[model samples]
Target: MNASLLRRHRGFSLVELMVSVVIGLLALLFATRLIVSGEKNKDAAVGGSDSMQNGMLALFSLSSDATAAGWGLNDPMVAGCDTSFSDASGYALPAMPRAGASITPLAPVVIQSNGANPDLISFNSGTSQAGAGSIKLFADYTVGNTLTVDSKNPYGFNNGDVMVIAPLTPGSGKCTLFQLSGFGPPPNSTILVNSGGAYRFNAIAGLPNPYKQNLAYIYNLGSPTLMHFHTWTVSNGVLLLRATELAGAEAAGVSVTDNVVSIKAQYGFDARPPGPNPYDPTPGADGMQITAWSGTMIDADSDGVAGSPGDYQRIAAVRIAVVARSKNAEKPNSAGLCTATPVAPTVFASSAPAGVAAVPVQVNVAVAGDTVSWQCYRYRVFETIVQIRNAQWRP
Candidate 1:
């Protein structure tokens, strides 16, 4: 009887058990919410910081490059009018290029620059073209015929081919191209190839440039709008992009990943009014002319031509816009991808109205050293416009 009765006090009473369970449940509930809240906050912070760092890096470099966009050491060396571009025939040299020809490529362009130059600047030896020169000087040009490519030379070339002109030496001749500004392709490149050579992008759009095309640089290391960088291709049904590695890698370009879902970009242009109300309506036009560039100038949709030339020319600036999301959204069971809730809210700076935001930031590539020296800084939109206009400086 003693042993049996001893077991009676060993078990928990009903009221005591209920109380213990309630206390435990409450603590667990609180702890779970705390952990989830902390994780959400951390994700938010990381996303915001990453966005900022990437934005600044991209903005600074593009700005500086644009600033020094067309700088060339020679009076008429071609620095950025689509260097190394070939016609539909695959030969980059165009038989004839008028002022208003289609500069926009329907597909990836195959072009290269070898810095070949005309031996002399012919002047008064005239045919009577008004723009023709009469004095003798070293001729520098945006265009030229290919000189011979000798295996023994830096410019290993065949005798009757074409090449962009550059100096035989780095900083010497008007006969050669020099970097007045420091962005885009080398002002005078004999040979520039990408890391994979021709292995990075869609096979159909392959080209020989190191980064597909010069200064065809992209954001987020060439994720979205990479079409802006070089070319796009499909190999065995897989989509890929080719990028020149700055250095060190076995085909170092990246493939699509889960964390980054979609990337879209828009170039920012300033639409200023001659006065302030550039948007006011005129008699015939939908609206009156304005100085500030608006969406009308942007080929964000990539229809090729800019809708407005005055506005396009005035595109004194550009900003890049991107959309990124977690790859988890692509999963079927995941809560609908378009959640009303944003794990991380983005912060942006804009000058437009309350509802509109401007993502493009300015860069000033202008500097005393090389025009490319501009890639390290930023500028106001119009300031960039001024620089673009100044690209016509001769001598």
Candidate 2:
């Protein structure tokens, strides 16, 4: 009776216990793998979101500035001229030359291309309170620090306002920038650019050339501190800005955004007339349509010289692509190479516009000097075409 009772309550064998332990271990291993996989996916999602946010911010900043370009300088005489100015504070315009020009054109937008790297874009505009209208010189302004305007008020010209002296004839091929210091005693037709007060842009010498009366106009560019002459570029995976009016001669740029690998841009040219005519009968007139896009400003009107004033006047829009990279470097595979990116990204890849043969703009995404290979990262491309409204609507 005792033996039968013991047999009925006997424990399980070693093999059965080992099988249960193995099952428990297998369950734990599966659960651990599931958690790791979920974490990796979450990381990837977060990284992508960061890239998207940064890209949008970068694009918006650039587009906003591009839209307001050539505000007070939209006149054909002022837009493409080689602008010259001296600053007492040592401020200087960008020394990097345009593709085919020696001096920087005083246009709405100027793009300086750097092969296999990010491009530099400069935006020139004025914040004049009296709008972008020009005030004719009352008398000849020949080789002096003072300008004689039509009336005493001179279109709300303030003491510290910046002004551009543009030749109405366009034959001078040059524009000069100066700061307004004050006005003559009572009937203030004499605008002074004297080197006194807190002015920084006025040089002691005065205007570089003698601007003749009835052939030139003084364009008020609001306060000297409010002038918008900004240059944008990407360096060391960050977007940077240098304002000629603010940061005067400071080569170290202000940081705009980070994780940006490249910035590619092209000029959207209104190269043709309204109908089938290849050239505009009126070169610098309105009603021109964007027929092609290019990196270097070409002879849009088939003029003898490329990057002529007519070519610059036809710049109605700019197409830009800003590339932002994921913050986190992706993990590598068993072969010790990252397959996350695997290939370089292409920019300005949209199909050619209706009549254009091809969009020749290309972007190189192989970033240099990274601990991890550039292929081990993910990227996002933000693209948009910003119209130069100020340029387009100018009279």
Candidate 3:
């Protein structure tokens, strides 16, 4: 009984204790490694999910704007039409393309710097309000500078509002874009269309002989209210969607979304014959097939003339690509991984127009001063084709 008690009370030997400690340490290390790997994978999944969400939102916003392009504005007439207008506030709105005009109605779809940096898209639409919202001829003043509206006119335009004036005569396509300078309050009504200085309605460049017409229709293109011109651009890692009148003050830009690294757009032109309507050129049975996908701007209507209105009239669809990156960095920054800029696919129609490049593009842009490598992060690519509803037909 004494010998048995001695053996039971005995502690482990030095060698046996060391082997037991080693086994315990190995098990602990294995568990820790497993946990770390799981956490890393979880992070990667969450980052990928965030990028997908960002990409979808950005694409939706872009699609909505592209669909609305060219709404309300009719096929412009070259006989006696003008595209330039300004208001008393010094905000210049040009319906036609100018050297640096931020808003251009002639080219309803404008893409800038397609592959390099983030591309800029400027889409234009007209206001769609009728009855009280519609333009009415109240009093045709001889001065041509001021026009009086009926007290019942409910449009209630404010200063710096962009307005479109069109002749209501049959077969008349004469229209002009102007800015509302001042207006009299409610009961008594006078709309000051121009406030001196190059702000007059005639500033529209080309007006037919015998300009003053009684039956004129006016459409209010909102200043900062309803968006008339949409400019999508990226600044400092943020995607901004600015909604304002072409004649609005510079203070009206609003940020739309974030985490959008870049946006690429290609113009889809349909060069088929005229539709049921001889003058209205429509995309043929092949479904407005893409003739050319331009990284820059393409003349929608080519009447074999330069700077003509025909270009904007033929645009049927737009193919857009939006790229998003994870907001968080998961791994250490390195020289090899996230340094190359993805090139825009030069191929058109087959797969490039669909936003798939002939070659798979891996964009791992390194952020300056970032400790984590961009390659250690996740990315998503979103692409969609938007057909301009208003641009489907020409007057």
Candidate 4:
């Protein structure tokens, strides 16, 4: 062998060494890119998982309350053209009967009470005559009517008294209404007219007003189910729903977490003047009107809307709206969930980008569309039409 050939074989050319280094560096670069890509993918998966969890949590919270929209109502407002929960808010009644709570009407629970059209009321078993009974009052309910108290204990009533009719049988919450004959103790014929107590009603769900006598809970549709009912007496002139000092809802099934800042509604009553048909709009006279709602009920109705030939209903119905704030936010007192201002229902709806219906939407992305992640907050509304099927008394 030649000495030069042996030396050449023993040592690598500079080009070979350089090529080897370049190849090694290229391999390192590719490996680094793969590692980085793997890490990025892992992070993306984790972020997606967290977003799903957050949404699930929000859904659970909304579901719990939404399902119970109108619960605990036994003979709720009857389903009718102008009755039930829908008549007022065009929505479902709350499962529970609490203040600032309402639903749309399904039927009309007509009211009446007068010489020819008597106003009736279901007896309160706990405090009705005979302890508990079901009686019907008739002030020509079919036509029109109203009433005034008996000058003696005229306005406002006591727990148990002998003033008007009683339920003929036992009934549920609606047992408070019925039409029976006869007036208090004296059953007089000479002193005819009875004094009336401005039977004003404040059904957070757009129910009838000032429950007078001769009223009926005509629940003629849906399954015969029982519901929970309660009363918020105006003890001492201040209104407050009897409630537990907790997050629990009132008898009008509704709930709120500490995370919920506030929930409120307004009552709008139709008004009319003194004249006759198609009366004028008075200040706050039309049948105990309630409107300008914002978690509050002001005497907006001018006490004019009658319940007779003029109109068998005082409060035509109410326009209920609510405002809720998120209890928790990234920043202290930050109203990122929703503006802290009272957004009018009409304005809110109209202000929304056009082409959207006022209803619950189920979106299922099609095969072709923008593919991106979203984290948005929404307030759900549930509504239904229920009626006063039967005003008969019950257990």
Highest lDDT model number: 2
Q: Model 2: per-residue lDDT, tens digit, 99-148?
A: 45577567888888775579988888899977676788778766767778
Candidate 2: which stretches are off by over 4 Å? 1-25, 87-91, 95-101, 138-142, 186-188, 244-251, 273-286, 357-362
Each prediction's Cα RMSD? 17.2, 3.7, 7.0, 16.8
**Candidate order by decreasing lDDT:** 2, 3, 1, 4
TM-score of each: 0.38, 0.86, 0.68, 0.28
Cα lDDT, all candidates: 0.27, 0.76, 0.57, 0.26
TM-score of 1: 0.38
Q: What range of 10 consecutive residues in model 4 has the weakest lDDT sum?
A: 116-125
Q: How close is candidate 3 to the true structure, as a TM-score?
A: 0.68
What's the best-to-worst order under TM-score?
A: 2, 3, 1, 4
Pairs with backbone N, CA or C atoms under 3 Å apart (clashes), candidate 2? none
Model 3 ranges with Cα > 4 A deviation: 1-10, 78-105, 130-144, 147-161, 165-176, 180-192, 196-224, 245-252, 272-289, 304-307, 333-371
Candidate 3 residue-wise lDDT, 297-342, digit = tens: 4444444532334445556678777778776657543545542223
Cα lDDT tens digits, model 4, 321-346, are 12121212111134444332223212
Index of the highest-TM-score prediction: 2
Q: How many residue pairs clash in all the candidates, one count each?
A: 50, 0, 3, 121
